[model samples]
Target chain A: MASIEITNARKSYGAVDVLHGIDLDIQDGEFIVLVGPSGCGKSTLLRMIAGLEEITSGDIAIGGNVVNDLDPKDRDIAMVFQSYALYPHMTVAQNMGYALTLRKTAREKVSAAIDNVAGILGLNALLQRRPKALSGGQRQRVAMGRAIVRQPQAFLFDEPLSNLDARLREQMRTEIRKLHRRLGATSVYVTHDQIEAMTMADRIVAMYDGIVQQVGTPLEIYDRPANIFVASFIGSPAMNFLSGTCQITAQGCALILDDGTSIPFLAPPNVSNGQKLTLGARPEHIDIVGNGSAPSVPATVDLIEPMGLSTLVHVTLAGKPVKIFTLARPDLAIDSTIEIAFNMDKTHIFDSETELRLPRANEPFAAETA
Target chain B: MSTPGKSRLRKTAYWGTHYLMIAAFVAFALFPLYWLLKVSVTPNDILYTEGVRMWPSRTTWDNYTFVLTQSHFPHYFMNSVIVSGFTALFTCIIAAVTGYAFSRFRFNGKIVIVALMLITQMFPLVMLIAPIFRILAPLGLTDSLTGLIIVYTAFNVPFATFLMQSFFDGIPKDLEEAAMIDGNTRFEAFRRIILPLTLPGIAATLGFVFTAAWSELLFALMLVSSESASTFPVGLLSFVSKFGVDFGQMMAAGVLALIPACAFFLLIQRYLVQGLTAGAVKG
Candidate 1:
C-alpha cells in the first residue's frame, strides 16, 4: 500500500488543456473515487497517476517518490481498463500472472500468486479458459485478479464496470468494494456514475470542466454540496433550484420569489437584505401536502414514475420542471394540482453568480472534510 | 409446422436465388481457367482445325511434355518462385513493423509519414518503371532476380502495410497496455500478446503479396534479359515467334504455373479461416 499525491497537475494536448492544475492527496490504503461527467478529465487524471499519460505540468508521487519521469512499468501501478483488455491469446491464469513474469519472478511464485488471486476472485475454475469463454462478470473478476496479483503500489480503475449489464455492474461494484476491503490496497477509481462513487469510495472527489468541484465523504457531498453543479450531479432525480432575492423579514430571513411569494429561510446574520440567491433542495427533502392547510406552492403533476420503493413525481414549479421523490403513493393524477412545502432546515442557498453555498444562520456551510 | 406446402416453397425460393448467384459467379471466374487447361491438352496439329471449338475431338499432353522438357519453363518457374517468395517475406516483415508503429505510436510526424506512404501508392507504376530500370542499371541490379524482388517489394509495401495496419487496428490498445502492466515491454507485448492474434492478417498479407509478385509482368520484362531470370508471365510470351503464337504451349505453361499458387493458398486457407483472436475479447 502507498500514499499518492498529485500536486498542481495539468494535462494538455497541444494548446487545449484537459486538466487544469489539479491538486489531490490520497492517504495510504484510502479508496478515492473520482466522479464526474464525460470529458471531465477524471480518467485523464487517473491515467496520469498510473503513468499512462504524460503530465503537462505537475508532479505525481507514489509512496513518497515522484513518478513524473517514470514509465508505467517503473511506476508500480496496475490499471483495470474499461475494455478489460485481457490478452486474447493467453488464458485467464496467464493473463493474471503476466506482470509477475515480466518482473522475472520465479515460475513457482508466479503460479502461487495467480492461484491466490484466483481464489480471492473465485476464478480458479475458469483459470484455464480464455477471456472470450468467460462471461462479462467473470472477465471483470479476471481483470481485477490481474491487477491484484501484481500487488502493485496502487490500483487504478478507469470506469471498469461501465461495460457490464446493470445487475452485473451492481454485483461487481460490491465485489470490488469487498476486494478493496479485504486487500486494503490503495486505489483510485474513476466513474461518471455518482452512485458508484458514493457506494464505493471512502472519499469522493467531484469534478466538472477539468476542475475539482469538491472533495468530501458521500454524506457530506449529499448533505452539503459546495456548488450548484455538485448538488445536482451527486443525487438521483437531482436537486431543485429556485431563483429569488434574499429578504430579511422581522422574525427571520426569507426569499422573495418572482411571483411575490416569500419563502422564509433560516439564514445567517451576515447575509444582507435584498441579495440575489438560488435556493436548493433535494427531491426527497420536499414534502407534497394535500391541501392549503400548510405553506406550499401550487404545482401540476407532469408525470409519475413508480420505482417500487418510491415514486418520482415530475411537476412544474415557478414555470420550471422539478422532480420530487415521494415514498407515499400520492393519490394525485396527471395534470392534477398539488401543494409542495420545503423543509427550510434542509434548504441550501447559493450565491447566484459564484454558485458557492451561502451561510445559513449559525450553520457553517463549509463542506464536510474527511 | 403443419404448413408443408408454404415451407417447401420458401426453402426452394431461398436456395434458388442463393445457388443461382453462386453458380453464375463460379462459372464466370472458372471458365477461363478451364479453357486454359482444355487448350493446353489439345494437340498442335488439331489446334487450328479445332478452332473456336469448346472441346477438341482428341487430346494429348505433347504441349505439356515439350514445354516441361524442351523449353526453359522450369528455370523461369524457379526464378519466379525465388523472387516472389523473397519479396513476400521481406515486404511482410517491413509492413508489420511499420504498420504496428503506425497503429500504436504517436511519434512526431506520424501523420506526415503515413501521408507520404499513401502518396507513394498514388503514382502509376508504369511511369516509374523506366526510372527504376535506369537506377538499377548503374547499380548492376538489372537483369538480376534481386532487382525484380526489390522493385516488387517497393511497389507492394505501401499496400501491404495498410493491410497489416487494419489488422493491427482491429486489436484494442488495452490488450497491449495490459501486457505492459503485466510486466512485458511494448515490443514484448507486441510479440507475445498481439502477434499471435494477428496470424489471419499475416496469412492474408502473404497470400496477397505472393500472388501480386507471381503475376507481375511489367517490371519482370523490363528488368531481366536472361531467359533464366524471366518470370513465368514473361516466359509465357516466349512461345510467340515472328510468324505466329504458340497458343497450345503457352496455355500449357500457364496451366502449370497456377499449380504452385493454388497449392500455397490451400496450405494457408486454414489459418486464413480461423479467427485466432475469437476468444480474446468481446464481440
Candidate 2:
C-alpha cells in the first residue's frame, strides 16, 4: 500500500490533447475514483499511472519513486480491464497464479496464494475451469482474483463491472468495496457511471473535456458542484438549469425568468442586479406546491414516472422543463397545471457568463474553491 | 395440434433441401477424384477398350506394384515431403512474427510496408521466374530442393501472414497488457499467453502452406531438373514419352501423391475447423 502522486500530467497525440495538465495527490490506502463521461480521459489517466501508456509530459511517482520510464512490471501494479481479460486458454488457477509464476516463486507458494485469493472470491470450484466456461460474473471474479493474488502496490480498475448485468454489477460493486477495505491497498478506479463513483469512492474526481471538474466526497460534489458541468453531471436525474436575470426586489434577490416569472432566493448572490444568471435545483429539492403560493412558479405537468420507491413528476416551469422527485405518489394527470417551489437554501446560483457557481451572501465563500 | 403437425412438415422440408444441396456439392467435387481412382485401378490392356466406363470389368494392382517397386516415385515423394514440410515450418514461423507485428504495432512506414507486401501478391509468378532462376544459379541454389523450399516459403508467407494477422486481431489486446502488468515482458506475454490461444491459427497456416507447396508445378518444373531433387509433381511427367503416354502409371503415381495431403488434412482437421469458425465469427 502506497500513495501515488501525479504532477502536471498532460497527454497528447501529436496535435490532439487528451488530458490537460492533471495534478492529483492520492493518499495511502485511499480508494479514489476517476469519474466522467466517455472520452473524458479518466481511463487514459489510469492507464498512464499503470505505465500502460507513456506520459506525454510531467511526472508520476509511486511510493516516492518516479515511475514514468519504468515498465508496468517494475511499477508493481495490477489492473482489471473492462473486458475481464483473463487468459482464455489457462484455467482459473493458472490465471490467478501467473504473476507469481513469472516471478519464479516456489510452486507451493504460488498455489497457496492462488488458493487464498480463490477462497476470498469463492472461486474454489472454478479453479479447474477455463475462462470461456465461466459465466460473466464468475469471469469478473477471476479477473479480480488474478489482481489480488499478487498484492501489488496499487490496483487499477478500468470499469471492471461495466460488462456485467445490472444485478451482477451491483453485487460486484459491493464486493469490490469490501475487498478494498479488507486489503487496505491504494486503488484507483475509473468509470463513466457517476452512481458507481458516488457509491464506491472515498473521494470522487469528476472530470469533463480532459479537465478535472471537481474532487471531493460524493455528497460534497452533489451539494456544491464547482460549475454548471459538474452540477449537471453528478446527480442522477440531473440538476435543472434555468437561464434568467438577477433582480433586487423588495423581497431580497429574485431571478426573473425569460418568461417573466420571478423565483425568489433566500439570500442574494454575489452578482450585480440585472446580471444574467443560471439557477440550478435538484429534483428532490423542489416540492409541488398548490396554486397561489407566494414563492412558487406555475408549471404544466408533462409526464409522470412512478418508480415504486419514488415518483418523478416532469413539468414545464416558465417554459423550461424541470423534474421533481417525491416519495408521495401524487395522483397527477398530464397537462394539469401545478405550482412548484424550490428549496431556496439548497438551490444553486451560477454566473451565466462564466458558468461558475456564485457564492451566496449569507454563506462562506468556500464552495467553488475546489 | 395442427400447428405442431404443420411445423414438423416444414422442418422436414427444410432439412431435406439442405442435405440435398450439400450432397449435390459433394458429388460434384468428388467425381474427378473418383475418376482418378478408377483409372488408376484399370488394367493397361483394357483401359482403351473400357471407353470411359465408370468401372472396369476387371481391375489390376499392376500399376501400383510397378510404380512402387520399379520407379523413382518414392524418392520424389520423399523430396516433396522435405520441401513442403520445411516450407510450411519456415513460413509459419516468419508469418506468425510478421502477423503479430502487423496486428499490434503502429511503427513508422507500417502502411507502406503492408502495401508493398500486398503488391507482391498482385504480380504473376511467371514474371519473376526468370529473374529468380538467374539469381539462384549464381548462388548454387537452382537444381536443389533448398531453392524450391525458399521460393515456396517466400511466396506463401504474405498470404499466411494475413491469415495469422486476422487471427491475432480477433484476440483482445487487453490480455497481453494484463500479462505485462502481471510481471511478464511483452515478448513473454506473446509467447506464453497468446501463442497457446493461436494454435488453431498456426495449424491452419501450416495446412494451407503445406498443400500449396506440395502441389506447386510451375516452380518445381522450372527450378529443379535433377532426378534426386524432383518433387512428385515434376516426377509425374516422367510417365510421358514420345512413344506413348503411360496413363495407368501416371494415375497410380497421382493417387499415391494424394495420400500425404489427405493424411495431413486429417491430422489437422480439428484445428482447421475450429480456426475457420472462430475467424468467421470474429470477421
Candidate 3:
C-alpha cells in the first residue's frame, strides 16, 4: 500500500486540453473516488496513475517514487476495466493467476494465490470454466479476482460495476467496500455515478470540467459544497437554487426575490447589502407547512412524484421550480398554493457573480475548506 | 377459420421453391466433378464409343493405374504439395504480423503502404509474367519449386493480409490493455491472448492461400520448364502431345489433384464454425 501524489498534472491532445493542472494528495490505505460526469477527466486521471496514459506535464509519485515514466506492468498496479476484459481463452483460474505467472512465480504458489482469491470472491466452483461460460456477474467477480490475486501496490477501478444490472451493482458495491476494508489497500475508483461515490468513497473528489470542485468526506461535501456546481451536482433530486439580491436590515440579512418577496436567513452570510446572491437548499431540508406560518413563502405545486418510501413534490417558488422531498404523503392538488419553509440554518448562500459559496459568520472556515 | 390452413399451404409452397433452387445450384456445381470421376473410371477403348453418355457400359481402373505408375504424375503431385505447402506457411506468417500492425498501430505512412499493397493486386498477372520471369531467371529461381513458392506467396499475401486484418479488427482492444495491466507486454498479450482467439481466422487464411497456390496454372506453366519441377496443372497439359490428347489419363490426374484441397478444407471446417470469442465482452 502507498500514498499517491499528483502535482500539477495536465493532459492535452494536440491543442485541445482535457485535464487542466489537477493536484491531489492521496494517503496510504485510503479509498479515494474520483467522481464526475462523462468527459470530465476522471478516467484520464485514473489512467495516468495506472501508467496507461502519458502525463503531458506533471509528477505522479507512488510510495514516494515518481512513476511518470514507468510502464503499466512496471508500475505494479492492477486495473479492473469497465468491460471486464477477461481473456476469452483462459479459464477463471488462469485469468486470476496471469500476473503472478508472468512474474515467473512457482506454479504451486500461483495456484495457491488463485485459490485464495477465488475463495474470497465465491468463485471456487468456476475455476475451470472459461470467461465465455460465466454470466455477467460472475465475469465481474473474476475481473476483481484478477486484480486481488497479485496484491499490487494499489487497485484502479474504472467504472467496473457499470455493466452489471442494478441489483448486482448494489451487491458488488458493498462487496468492494468490504474487500477494501479487508485488504487495507490504497484504491482509486473512478465513476460518473454520484451515489457510487457517496456509498463507496472514504474521500470523494467531485470534479467538473477537468477541475476538482471539492474533496471531502461524503457528508462534509453534502453539508458544505464549495461552489454552485458542486452544490447542484452532488445530490439527486438536486439542491434548489433561487436567484435574488441580498438585503441587510436592522434585524438581520435577508434575500429579496424579483417578485418583491423576502426570505430571511437565520444568520447573515458575509455579503454586501444589495449584492446579487443565490440561495441553495437541499430537497430534504425544506418543509411544506400549513398556511399563516411565519418566515414561509407561498408556492404553487407543479408536480408530485411518489417513490413509495418518500415523495418528491415539485413546486414553483419565487418564480423558480423547486423540488422538496418529504416522507409525508401530502394530498395536495396541482397548481394549489402551499406554504414552504427553508430550514434557515441549513440553507447555503452563494455569490451569483463568482458562483462561490458565501461563508456564514457562525461557520467562518467551512466554505474555505469545502 | 380457413386462414390458418391457407397460411400453412403458403409456407409449404415458399419452402418448396427454396429447396428446389438450392438443388439446382448444387447440381450445377457438382456436375463437372461428377463427369471427371465418370471419365476416369471409363475404359480407354470405350471412351469414344459411348460418346456423350453419362456412364459407359464398361468400367475399368486402367486410367488410374496408368497415370499413377506409367507416367510422371506422382512426381508432379509431390512437387505441387511442396510448393503449395511452403507458400501457405510463409504467406500466413507474413500476413498475421502485417495484419496485426495494420489493426493496432498508427505508424507514419500506413495509408501509403496499404495503398501500395492494393495497387499490386489491381494489375493483371498476365501483364507482369514476362517481367517476373526475367527477375527470377537472374536469381536462378526459375524451374525450381522454391521459386514457385516465392511467387505464389507474393501473389497471395496482399489479399490474405486484408483478410487477417478484418479478423483482428473484430476483436476488442480492451483485452490487450487488460493483459498489459496484468503484467504482460503488448507482444506477449498478442501471443497468449489474441493469437489463440484468432485461430479461426488463421485457419481461413491458410485454406485460402493453400487452394490458390494449389490450382495456380499460368505462373507454374511459364516458370517451370523441366519435367522434374513440373506441378500437376502443368503435368496435366503434358498429356496433350504432338499426336493427340489423353483425355482418360488427364481426367484421372485431375481426380487425384482434388484430394489435397478437399482434405485441407475438411481439416479447418471445425474452427470455421466455432465462435470462440462470443462472450469475451458485453454485446
Candidate 4:
C-alpha cells in the first residue's frame, strides 16, 4: 500500500488550462474518491497519479517517491478503466495476471494470484473465457479482478462501474468497497457520480472546474459544503437555492426575496444586514408542517415524484424551484400552496457574489474549513 | 420479422429479389474469370473454331504445359512474386507504424503530414511515369525488380495507411492505457495489445497491396526493360506478337496469375471476418 501526495498539480493543453493548481494527500489504506461533473478534470487528476498523464506543473509522489518522470509501468499501479479495456484476445485468467506476467513472474505464481483474485470476485467460473464471452456485469468483475491480482502499491479506478446496469452498478459499488476493506490498499477512484463518491470513499474530494471544491469525510462534505458548487453538486435532487438578500431586523433574521417575499432564518454573524446572498436547503431538509412553529414559507407545489419509500415533492418557493423529500405521501394537487419550513440546523447560506457557502452560527469554522 | 403488419409472403418475395440481384452481380463479375479458366484448357487448333463457344468440344493441357515449361512464364511469375511479396511486406510495416501514430498521437504538423499523404494519392501514376523513370535510371534501380518494388510500395502506402488508421481508430484508447498500467511500456502495449487486435486490418492491407503490386503493369512495364526482371503482366504482352494474338497462352497465364492472390486471400479471409476487437472495450 502507498500514500499518494500531489502538490500544486496543474494540467494544461497548450494555451488552454484543464486543471488548476490542486493539492491532495491520499493516506495509506484510504479510499479517496475524486468526484465531479463532466469536464471537471477528476479523471485527468487520477490519470496523472497513475502516470498515464504528465503533471504540467507539480509534484506527484507515490509511496514516498516522486513518479512524475516515471512511466505508468514503473509507477507500480493498476487501473480499472470504465470501458473495462480487457484484452479481447486474452482469457479471464490471463487478463487478471497480465501485470504479473509482464513482470516475468513465475507461471504458477501468476496462476495462483489470478485464482485468489478470481475467487474473491466470484470469477472462478469465468477463468477460461475471453472478455467477449462475458456479459457486461461479468466483464466488470473481470476488470476489477485484473486490478486486484497484481496487489500493486495502489489501485486507480476511472469510473470503472459506469458501464454496468443500475442493479449491477449498485452491487459492484458495495462489492468494491468490501474488496478495498479486505485488501486495505490505498485507492484513488474518479467518478462523476456523487452517490458513488458518497458510498465508497473514506474521504470524498469534490472537484469543480479543475479546482478542489472540498476534501473531507462524506458526511462532513454533505453537512458542510465548502461552496455553492459543492453544495449543489454533491446531492441528488440537488440542493435548492433561493436568490435573496440577508435582512436582520428586530424580529429575528430573514431573507428578502427578489420578488418581495421574505423567508425567515437565523443569520450568521459574518453575513451582515442587507447583504446579497443565496439560501440552500436540501430536499430532505425541507419539511411541511401544519402548526408552522419553525421558520415557514408558503410555496406552490409544482410536481411530486413518488420513489417507493420516499416522495420527492417539487415546489416553487419565492418564485424559485425547490424540492422537498418526505416519507409522508401528501395528496397535494399541482400549484397548491403548502407551508414548508427549512430545518434551520441543516440550512445552508451562500454569498451570491462569491457563490460560496456561508458558515452557520453553530459552526464558526465551516466557512474556513469546508 | 414478425413486426406488426408485415406479411410472410411479402418478406419472402423481398428476400428472393435481394438474392436474385446479388446473384446477378456475382455472375456479371465472375464471367470473365470463368472464361479465362475455360480458354486455358482449350486446344490451340480449335481455339478460333470455338472462339464464341463457352466450352470447347475438345480440351487439352498443351497451353498450360507450353506456358509453364516452354515459355518464360515461370521466370516472370517468380519475379512478380518477389516484387509483390516484398512490396506488401515493406508497405504494411511502414503503414502500421505511421497509421498508429496518426490514430494515437497529436503532434505538431500532423494535419500537414496527413494532407501531404492524401495529396500523394491525388495524382495519377501515369503522370509521374517519366519523372520516376528518370530518377531511377541514374541510380541503377531501373530495369530491376527492386525498382518496381519501391515504386509499388510508395504508391500503395498512403491508401494502406489510411485503411490501417481507421482500424486503429475503432479500438478504444483505454486498452493501451490499461495495458500501460498493466506493466507494459507504450511500445509493448502497441506491440502486444494493439498489434494483435489489428490483425484483421493488417490482413486487409496485405491483400490490397499484394493485389495492387501483382497486377500493376504501368510501372512494371516502364521501369523494367529486361526480360529477367519482367513481371507476369509484362510477360502477358509477349503473347501479343505482330501476327495474331496468342489467346490460349495468355488466358492460361492469366488463370495461373490469379492463384497466389486467391491463395493469399484464402489464408487471411478468417481475420477479415473475425472482428477480433469485439469485446476490447464496452460491449
Candidate 5:
C-alpha cells in the first residue's frame, strides 16, 4: 500500500472548471470517501487520481512519484465503475483475472489470485458465468473482485454501489468495509450518498459546487461541521436552520427567533451583542417537553413518519417545516398542537453574514476553528 | 357466452385477410424467379411447344450440363467472386475504422466530414461513370478487375460506414475504459474487447456490400471490357445476342450465380442472428 497526495489539483473541460484547486494528503492505507451530490466533481477528482482524466493544473503524487502525465495502467490504480463495467463476454473468472492476464502473470498464479478474491467475495459458484447472467449484487462483487485480484497500488471506486437496491447497497457497504480491513490498501471511494460515506469512510470529503466543503472523520464532520453546508449535508433528514438574532441577555447569549421566541446558546466571548446569527439544531436533539420545566414552544404536527426504531414528527414552526425525531411516540394527530424544547447544550450558532459556525466556549466539546 | 360464435367468426376473418395479403405479395415477388427456373429445366425441343406455361411439360438437366461445360460461366463466376470478395473485405475494414471514429471521437470538422460523406451518396452513379472511365482509361485501370474492385469499394463504403457506426454507437464507452485500466493500450482495447463485440455489425456490413458488388452491372460494364475481367452481371449479358436469346443457358447461369451470395449469407448468419453486442450494456 502507498500513500497518495493530491496537491492543489485542478480540472477543467476547456473553460468550464469542474474541480477547483484541491489539496488532500491521503495516509497509507487510508480509505477516504469523496461524497457529494451529482455534478459536484467527486467522480472527476477520483478519475484524476486514477489517471482516467487529465489534471488541468497542480501535482498528484502516488508513492512519492509524480504521475500527472502517466496513463492509468502505468499509474497502478484499479477502479470499479458504477455500471460495474465488467467485460460482458468474459466469464467471471476471466473478468477477475484480466489485469493479471495483461501483465502476463503465470496462469496458475492468475487462477490462484482469482480464486482467492472470488472465495472472499463468495463468488465461487458464479465463476464461469458471464456478466449478463449475474445479478446486480453479483456483478458488483465481480467488479470489486477484479480490483482485489490484482492488488493495485490504490483502489478508485466511482460510485460502485449506486446501482444496487437499498438493501443490497447496505449489505455491500459492510462487505466493502470488511474487505478494506482485510486488504488495507489505499482506497478513494466516490459516492453521492452521505449514508454510505458516514458508514464506510475513514474520512469523508464533502464537496459542493466543485469545491471541497469539508474533510474530516465522519464523527468529526457530523459533530463539528465547519459551515452551514457541511452541517446540513452530513446528517440524515438534515439539520434545521432557524434565522434569528443574537442577544446577550441576563441568561447568557440567547437567540431570538422570528416568532419572538428566545433559545439560549453558549456563544464565545468574542460575539458582540445584537449580532445577526442563525440557530442550527439536529431533529434528534429536539425533545418534546412537558410544561413548566424548560422553555416551551408551541408547534403543530404536520405529519408523522414511523421508522420502526424511531418516530419523526414533522411540525410547522414559525411558518416553516421542522422535523423532530424522538424514540417516545406521542399520541398526536395531524394538525394537533404540541410543545417541544430545543437542547441548549447541543445547538449550533452561525454568523448570518459568513455562515461560519461560531465556536462555543464549552468545557470538553471540540469547537471548530475557522 | 353466446357471443363466442361471433368472436370466432371475426377472428377467422382477421387472420384470413392477413394470410391473403401475404400470399399475394409472395406470389408477386416469386413469379419471375419461378419463370427463370421453369425455362432453365424445360428441354429446348419443347420451348415453343410449352410456351407461356408455368411448369415444363418435360424437365431436363441438359441445360445445366451444357452451361457448366460449354460456356464461360465458370470463369465469369470466378471473376465475380474475386471482385465481390475483395470489395467486401476492403469496404468492411475501411468502414469499421471510419465508423468507429465517427461514433466515438469529437475531432474538429467531424460534422463537416460526415456531411461530405453523405453528400457523396446523393450523386447518381451513372453520371460519374463517364468521368470515372476517362480517369481509369489513361491509368490503364479500365478493363481490370482491380479497377472494378476499387470502384465497388468506393461506392459501398459510405452506406456501410453509416451502418457500422450505429452499431458501434450502441456499445457503451465504459467497456473500453475498463480494458485500458486493465493494462491494454487503447488500440489493443479496440481490437480485443470492442472489435469482438462488433462482429454482428461487421458481418452485416460485409453481407450488404458483397451482394451490392456481386450484382452491380453498370460500373462493371463501363470499366471492364476484357473478357477475363468481366463480372457475372456483365457476363449475364453475353447470353444475349442479335439472334434469338439463349434462355436456358442464361437462366442456368443466373441460378449458378445465386450460390455464392447464398453461401456468403450462410457463413455470416450466426453472428448476424446472435446480435453479438446484446449483453454488452444494460440496455
Candidate 6:
C-alpha cells in the first residue's frame, strides 16, 4: 500500500558495527525480498523499518514520513515473526482482530474486518479455537491473517515459513505469493533461503558481510551477478569458480588454468594477456564433450549424483572441484578422464583481485550496468 | 531362544526395585503427618499408654472440640490467615513486575541489582530480626499483623521474583513484539499478552509464599508479644505448662494449622503443572 525508503541506515552494538551504511528505495506495492546467509543484517534492516529497532545512524521513511523516532504501533506496520507468535491465550478470532481492538474500533467493524481476513485465509472453522489447538501451518495462516486484518502501511515477514516442514513450506510459499499478488501490498520479506527470494520477490536484494551485494531481478542476478559473493550465493548447485590466467594466441583467446589445462574461450575486451582472473561457470552451462575435442579442458570425473529429473556430475578440473548438471545420465567411471567445454556465451570472467564480473568482448558493458 | 523371557524378568526386577525405593521415600516423608494425625485423636487418659502405637487403641474428639471452642487458638488461626494472605498477595504483585523487567529488559545496573537481591538472601534471618524489630517499634508496627505481613513479604520476594523470572524467560519475546506491532503499546502488550501467559507462575508464587508465611515460627515469636496478634505457632505454646506439657491440645492445634495450607495448594494445583507456554511458539 505504501513505499518504504531507507537511507544510509547503519546499526552497531557499541563499537562493533553490524550494518554499514545502507541505502535503498523501495517502490510502492512491490514485493522485495532481502536474502543472505545468517548475520547479514537483513532482519535488522527490516526491524529498523518496522520501528522495532533504532537506527544507530540515518533515517527510514514509510509512506513519505520518517519513522525513526516512532514506536512500532505509530509506524503502522505489521510483522509475521518466524515463531508465528500467536497469542496462546486468545482464540484465532481474537488474535486476528487484536490490532483493530487496540485502536478501539467499533465491534461490528472489527468483526467484519476479521471475517474478511478469515475468509481469505480459510480460518472460519478454526476461529473459535486457541493457538494451542492449531497445527503449525494453521498458526502461520493465523499470523498472516492478523497482519492482513490490520491493513497497515506495509507488511514485514522475517523468515515466516522457516518453522514449517518442507512439504508445508513449499505449499505455503506459493500461497503467500498468490496472496501478495491479490493484495498488492508493499511487502519486505527476509529469508536466508535463496530459493524463496528467487521465486517470491519482484526484486531480490542479495547481501553479504553487512553490505548490499546486488539488487536486481532474479534472472538478472542469476545471469550476471555483480560480484563473486552474489554469483556463488544465488544459484543451487552453485556456480563454480576456477583460477586461471588470461592468454591470447593466434587461433583465439584461452584461459590457462593453474594446473596448465588450456580452456579456450572468447575473452572479454578489457582483459590483457597474462592477466590473472577467476572464471565462473554454472553447472548447467558446462558440457561433457568428446574425449579428444578441441577447445576443451580434460577433467577426471569424481562422483555422479542421479537426480530423478536431472543428473549432476562432479568432476575435478585443473585440481579444483566443479559440478556439471545435465539431463542425460552419463555412464562414466570414477577417476576416468573426460573433456568438458564451457559455453563461452554463458560463462563469467571476474578480475581475481576485485572478484567482480568482467564484461565480455562481444557485448562490452551490458551485464555490469544491470 | 529364551531372550524374551529373560528380558521380561529383568524389566520386572528393575521396576520392582524402583517402586520399592519410591515407596520408602514417600513413607519417610509422610510419617510425621501420620503421627500428628494419630496423636490428635488419642484420648488424653491413654496418651502415655499409647505412646509409639500406630493406632491409638481408643480415640476421642474431645481434643478437637476443646481446641476449637475452649482455647485462644481460633483467634491465632485467624491472625495467621490474615498475615499469610496479605503476604502472598503483596509478594506476588511485586515479584511479577520485577521479574518481568528482569526477563525482558537490559537496563542500567541490572546485573548489580540482581546480585544485591542474591546477597540479601545470603545473610541469616536471625541476624536481622533484632534490627527489624527495632525499626518497626518506632513506626508502631512491631506487635501487629500488618508488621508480620510486611516482613514476610520482604523475605519471600527475592526467591519469588527468581521463580517468576524463570517462567517469564520460557516465553518467547516475539509474542509481545508481535502484540506491539498489532497496535498495543509495550505496557499494554505486557498486561494483555505476557501477563496472561504468566498466570501459572503467579499462582505458584502465591502458593509458595502462603505456605512459607503460614508455618513461619521464628519471626512470629520474635516480633509479636500480645496474645491478640499471636499466630498459631505462638498460641500452641500456651498449652505447655510448668508442671507438664499439654500434648493432646498441642497436637490438636498443630493438626488444625495444616488445613489452610493443604487447601491452598489444592486450589492452585492445576496451574502448578507446567506446559502453559506450549503452542505459543513453533512448538
TM-score of chain B of 1: 0.95
Whose TM-score is greatest here? 4
RMSD to truth, every model: 2.3, 2.2, 2.9, 1.8, 2.9, 1.9
| Residues A182-286, model 5: lDDT tens digits | 999999999988999999999989898888888889998888887898899889989988888888977787888888877777786578888899888999888
For candidate 3, lDDT tens digit of each residue in A299-331? Answer: 999999999999999999878999999999999
- Select the stronger candidate by lDDT from 1 and 5: 1
Best by DockQ: 4
Candidate 2 chain A — worst ten consecutive residues by lDDT sum? A361-370
Ordered list by TM-score, greatest first = 4, 2, 6, 1, 5, 3
Interface CA RMSD of each prediction in angstroms: 1.5, 4.9, 1.1, 0.7, 1.7, 0.8
Distance from true position, residue A365, model 3, in Å? 3.7
lDDT of 4 at B280: 78
Mind giving the per-residue lDDT tens digits that candidate 6 earns over A1-370? 7999999999998898889988888999999999999999999999999888889999899999998999999999999999999999889999999999989999999999999999998999999999999999999999999999998889999999999999999999999999999999999999999999999999999888778888888888888798888889999989999988989989887888877888877787778899998899999999999967767888899999999899999999988999999999889999999999999899999999988888775663354231
lDDT for A300 (candidate 4) = 93
> Model 5: which residue pairs collide?
none
Error of 5 at B119 (Å): 1.6
Error of 3 at A19 (Å): 2.1
lDDT of 5 at A135: 85
Q: Compared with the true structure, what per-residue lDDT tens digits does model 3 show for residues B228-273? A: 9999999999899999998999999999999999999999998888
Ordered from best to worst DockQ, the candidate numbers read: 4, 6, 1, 3, 5, 2
Off by over 4 Å in 6: A250-252, A361-370
Provide DockQ values for all models, in the order shown: 0.68, 0.49, 0.67, 0.88, 0.51, 0.83
Q: Where in model 3 is the C-alpha error above 4 Å? A: A242-276, A294-300, A316-321, A335-337, A367-370, B1-17, B51-54, B241-244
Runs with alpha carbons beyond 4 Å of true place in candidate 2: A267-269, A362-370, B1-3, B275-283
- Where does the lowest 10-residue lDDT sum fall in candidate 3 chain A? A361-370
Candidate 5 at A335: error in angstroms? 1.5
